[model samples]
Target: MDLTMSCSSLSLLFFISLHIHFLVPGSGKFLPFRECAPFVCGDKNISYPFRHNERPTHCGYPGYELGCDGHNPTLVMESLTYRVIHMNTNMQILEVARKDLSDDLCHGAHVNTTLNSSLFNYTSSDLNSILFYDCDSSPIFGSYPFSCPTSGDSYFAPVVDLEHLPQELCNFSVLVPISQSDEAPDRPPPSEDSDFGAPINHAARISEILNKGFEITWIANTAQCENCTESGGICGYDWKRQRFNCFCTDGAYSPTCNGTRVPGSFPSRNKKMGLKVGIGMAALGAGIVVTLILMRALIKQRSVHFDGEMKIEGLVSSRRYTYKDIKRMTNSFEEKLGQGGYGCVYKGKLGDSQLVAVKILKKLKGDAEEFFNEVASISRTSHVNVVSLLGFCFEGSKRALVYEFMPNGSLEKFIFNRSNTLEVDRQLSWDTLYQISLGIAHGLEYLHRGCNTRILHFDIKPHNILLDANYCPKISDFGLAKICSRQESIVSMLGARGTPGYIAPELFMRNIGGVSHKSDVYSYGMMVLEMVGRRKNIEVAVDRTSETYFPHWVHRRLELRQELGLHGITNEEDEAIAKKMIVIGLWCIQIDPRARPCMTQVVEMLKGSVDTLQFPPKPLLSSPSRSLAACPCESSSLQEGNDSSWGYSISIIRDRLSL
Candidate 1:
């Protein structure tokens, strides 16, 4: 039986080799090249390396495929579609324009053009042009003002004049690539004599430049393709093998068509030695396939068992404690620390006499998936500025979280005058306040960028920031936090999060932008403003006759070049620190989320000198009349006077107040 099985296998291998060498046409010689011929889309000629979707997969290089939308050819790269304008195969360059921006400039969503760096690179002949949208004020110097009939105010400027343009005044700006010709001098600046004709001429000029498109040199295996074509063979790619192949009448060869057979291609053989070699090769391939299958099964089985054990251990790790243990650690709830919407907090001590703060969570109706997930996320964080989670207790409805104790408690007590008299008597110095702000910014920066999983502390205010013995600030209270992958730019929320006074405008109004890490920056800005003002941002006057928005008042004072008049400014250094904090806070609270700096930028700004800081534009929500409590409920009333900014502010205020 063993001899018969061996004979059967050898006979099968010989039959396959005979079939390949005789039966299938070009099977051992070449691939069908008729389907890979050059084609035409619109007026452009599409050839080798760039194939239409109708062509076979082997006809084009990977990621260089195109699709036809009616008569025009479109290429989708990195999610943005572009209309092909011209292709220079000799120079390996392509000229294309953004399909969305080709017909109407302001019709699409605000997004900058981006290219895949590995596949294409911008040519030096292309210059960057900035398009500023929803600008509150016209540029004072080097920008050409324009208006979109449907989208209101906008501005345009060349890259050379970026410093002169009022970018801070704009809600958002997009960087677009445009062709720069030597004859035109790169969109000549508007003349001093004709203000009216300048805008019209500039708008037309911008349209022409964008339509002309920009050039990008494509990165491909051009040298290999050229060698293959020079050898009188058709150049193509092997989709299955994921490499270049040259197709000749005799066979398909790699690198070049030099009458060489690729692996697996069988030729005619007449000797016993050749038959034995073919049989051995076939048996070896079969053995390798079988070995791979067995190894894959073993690895998968071990992985499942290991993952199951890890999960079981992770569920009942050292960090988890029983409800009975919590009672003994907290001394039967004897010493109360604080209480909030989540639950009450109590001072506790471990068996080693180490201090801790235990937060007893309220009873939730559903399973504890979200609870355990949040605990796991917090456990992974090890930053000094972030409060550490020591242990947790989740037995039935009784749940609690243990954290490392902060001797100084929350920051609100010291910042708010009415909270603690002792804390007010020993007021924090300006330097201390600045350090706290910088520390909090560092904490946020770590959460946003340094961690494996990005943690968005939706609630970022004075009340959520805790100070240690050395007065170092640590971000606390993850009740409303959202954990997402670091690659995620925007997170989806069912509804608005964060406190009313410190919430970002985009949380309640979708028109502002998506909810992202920028939202946390806004909250941080509001808190810093409160720390500088030493009062609530929106407060009624002592006489109760008028309401004042502190941010607006601070902006007016700065614009007038008057003293900030803040307390604890005994020297020029103190004055400079206060001014720097004010300027940074203003920048963080811009109406459009895109205008706000990231937490990393905020950290850099805090470390830099006051002279390096630029004064931010007037925040749209800074008006006293637009206070969350004062805004009218009717949408029509909010939209009156063609004031879109006011409308957005009113909408945000209404939603936040209702929440």
Candidate 2:
């Protein structure tokens, strides 16, 4: 009977131990194990969403837990070891390099990468997919001519073009993913001659690419975890509770860390067991508390950047890059294309061989507001005439915008010429000029009416027009832009915008009409006038003989039905284009803001015949008083129009006439 009672007690004790391990909730089991920083392995600094060995399961999300193997922080996801390089909370990116792969990466890269499908996915950045193929000498070998030689006869060749390999010599294949630097030169297409081999160094390039590491973005079922992570709290999903838990420095919190003191809200465990667990737990807890207090004090002494603005809420769709990434893309800003009041632009290349122009804004008053404004406005625009906003970087005070590179540069150089002897073939033809004019008008119309909101390009001038390789015009420079609802007829502004010659009269003083899209029309008109005369309208040095304002002279000549006296209007068609542009310009530059046609009207007028256009009255009389010839056009003024300006080359005119 004594042995039976002893055995029964032992069995009951064993059952209770099993129950406590799996079911009973304890202070240490549910709570974070009193740690401020999550990591100290190698050079890695671990933070939110990723928990280390010192942390409880509640401190980090599942599939993101990391273990330390000696000096390296190893992540065992999808049954592979990935060395943690860095983790960025703002970017929500985790970069990990393949630890199993050899350092040389070329001769033998048997290691492969796969993300935790439940929680993460590979970043959408362009990656080169390398497929390893085993092959023997056969007719099919020519398709995959380039080889990764292994044995004396057999080789591993990377075949990109071919889809299938015949059973005669083919063994098997495996695919590997590698992240590459965006600045790598584009590989040229393979030649028809296979034996010549590929130009790009596939082995060295790909190995370097793997060493750079890969990015995986976490995806939780709900934004609860995202909010918790953003609030500087560790986010972890409770497998047993089937809900997200935000763990703060104090203790495990609900929804978020509200700064309230710790409380015993957890399910109660057996009280008899508390003393046994409490004595040892109390000793460990006291040591952890002291360490945490010292760490908190040290961390508080460090300085923090004013980078909070970079994490603008609701700006997630656009890719956010680090300052280091920006430097790499721009090649340390080595090739500067141009510099303006807003920023400096540099030529750059993306990993996929696409050329780009990166604009780094200068630090100035209202820099933060302007940075966000430019991003917000440009990101909403998607048109052929509008420059594309590819990506952006906002780390601390350094901010930048990446755009598609326009080889031809701004239209200022093409339009503004100092010399009269420049050749004609080198210049743009009247036909091309008309099409570009029409394209600009179409883009303007889209911004005004087509977009969900009206975008008023406050500054529209020759300098802002950008031309592509095909001479197609695209509007750029949105530093002075404004957005208003379609219903709001007139937009509000504190002061006048645009360059001296291009700004509308009403913007300076609301005498003509309230500021509206019509203001953009006025600027466009001045630019079109410059395009026709091929010289500055007010006081350009193209010809010294004429002191009169240029547009007034063109108006008088048109009123008299006289010859335009343009150098490039050799043929009937050339003359017709010149007349069309002149008529459009005269209408756009009218002093009365109401008198100027909307962008929609301008587009139609450019498409219509020159004969249908009515001569516009002289606009100078309605402007602020200025010294000029009493008449709109005099003999001297007409002669000045006849002077060979920078463009309007005679050969180009004659060629058009001959055609």
Candidate 3:
């Protein structure tokens, strides 16, 4: 025990001496920077030269400590706390503003802005001036003035150089930094009749000008990082010592790790000590990553679902739960929420009390293509409108996907009464329906353009639209989703996907146009039109047994400026919202895929005023029978009943035109 204590004490003494000497005895280096941890404070990410208190001593520059006050990140300099607006690592510049300052002059004004000269330098781009508060008399006309509670005594010096200012006219003053353009201007002196006691109309003017925040450039430059980079070491700041710290592959060090000779050129005096340091460094990420990978591989090997497959991709962003946990949380799959073509969703509670919908895939083989596609496609997205994939269970044949449990069920239940019951009890307001349309538009935009990879949700209908607690629409069910490179403009397809009513005209027949993002637009337009008309767009007529497409009927009403016959469209505002949706929806379901607007344009049109929207051409897709009869060539092989996927397809007109 004494020997053990002696060795430990000697190790501590060696560490202290190494820190003091700035070297590791004869090793001629410090230690690796594995201790540093980069993290996000509020919305800002902190790293080298700027760190939170939880970071290590070698993490950031001295005097650049940051702390979070609740959710907002703050930086204290010279006894004043400033809210960090943003920090750019490449520019080495930081934007911060006084936390106490307000954008409203009706409130109060008090600012003490100061920057340590050694650590920060006000770049030439930044504007500066002395702001004096409450002087006996206001300064000359050029000095920006504000009407405070007393009078127009509050004013700021205009010129950047402080010496030119008339010192005799000022009272309490502090040097403040502001943006170059649009500096504060003096408020007009109130006349005798003017109410001095009453706060001015533009009370927020002064605060607004000053609230833009100031930028500060760090003293460190490229030269400091140059030498370190050449020696295969990363240059960083040591906050405690107030100096540069170079983090190297083998170990961290001061000065430069380029010193001495090549690592293999010189023989180490003590190999045993070097081996111990090497082992410590390996455990950080490099060696640890492999160990983790091996353990996961072994776990996957024993799983019934993944036994045949070595690995799967695109599901790394979400968690993987065990079958026992899934069963316990779901109460043995008792509370079934809904069932679809792929699986059944059961309501479950996570350990953290978060309600989740666990979708258990039925009869799927270990390497089912649909299972991978669903998991891989949904996992790549993180948008409010897009359904979030919380976790999954792939224990052999029991494949289940976990998602945030939506309180309200699928939108189909509310929008159209699936049950043939004539119970018109609670109808969703026009406002709620309009908002849902916009939300669905934004979701499609995110999938097609916002994410890293382009995701095309082939199936986009009212049945697949799930509503949450607030009736906000979440686009769910990625059974027919396709992931492609953003660079790839068009995607190839094997067979037709999606419900017949909502499928794009082009997807039915490629001749109309190559399959692109507009396909989803066509689907969204069809679904939204049904929401506006309050009936299935493609209902089978009882008398003639012919299909009644909604976009055509809605377009006719819009063209003639007739009443839409919407259930909740009581007032002008509700009528306008309904009319706006019908117009945009018609534009989306244009027979020629090219005639339809993209999802982005769809969102814009929905947001735009009803007066601005223009009626689209009569939907030719609604009456394909007329076009076929008009065809001069009777032998043209445009068979109607050949394809069951598209019973009322636009391909008839598309193929007819090709003739």
Alpha-carbon lDDT, every model: 0.70, 0.63, 0.65
**Residue 162 of candidate 3: its Cα lDDT?**
39
Rank the candidate models, highest lDDT first. Answer: 1, 3, 2
Worst 10 residues of 3 by lDDT: 629-638
Please, what is the TM-score per model? 0.48, 0.49, 0.49
Which candidate achieves the best lDDT against the true structure?
A: 1
Model 1 TM: 0.48
Model 1, position 555, has a per-residue lDDT of 80
**lDDT, candidate 2, 1-659, per-residue tens:** 46445444543443334223322344434334244245667776665567785666655666667888766677877676777666666666677777655254434444445555447766544232333445455323322223455632222232221222344554543344444333444433446223465322345544554556767666654457667656666666564345666656444566777643223333334445565454435444544544454347533443233333532556654667777877888789889999988779999887787899998988644435567666776777888998888888876677888888999998777666665334565577789889889989988998898888888888899888989999888888777778779887776443356787788866643333467888899899999888877777766433523335778788778878888887677799998999899988987877656556788778878988787776665665243222321211112111011111222122321121121
Angstrom error at residue 323, model 3: 1.3
Candidate 1 residues 77-193, lDDT tens each?
Answer: 868888888888888888888887677776644777777654687664565666777778664334556677766577665432332345678877876777654233232333531
Candidate 3 per-residue lDDT over residues 40-150, each given as its tens digit: 777776665666776655666666678887666788787777777778778888777776654344233454466765477554334454466667665433345565575
**Model 2 vs truth, CA RMSD:** 24.1
lDDT for residue 174 in candidate 2, whole number 0-100: 34
The reply for model 3, stretches above 4 Å from the true place, is: 1-311, 419-425, 541-547, 622-659
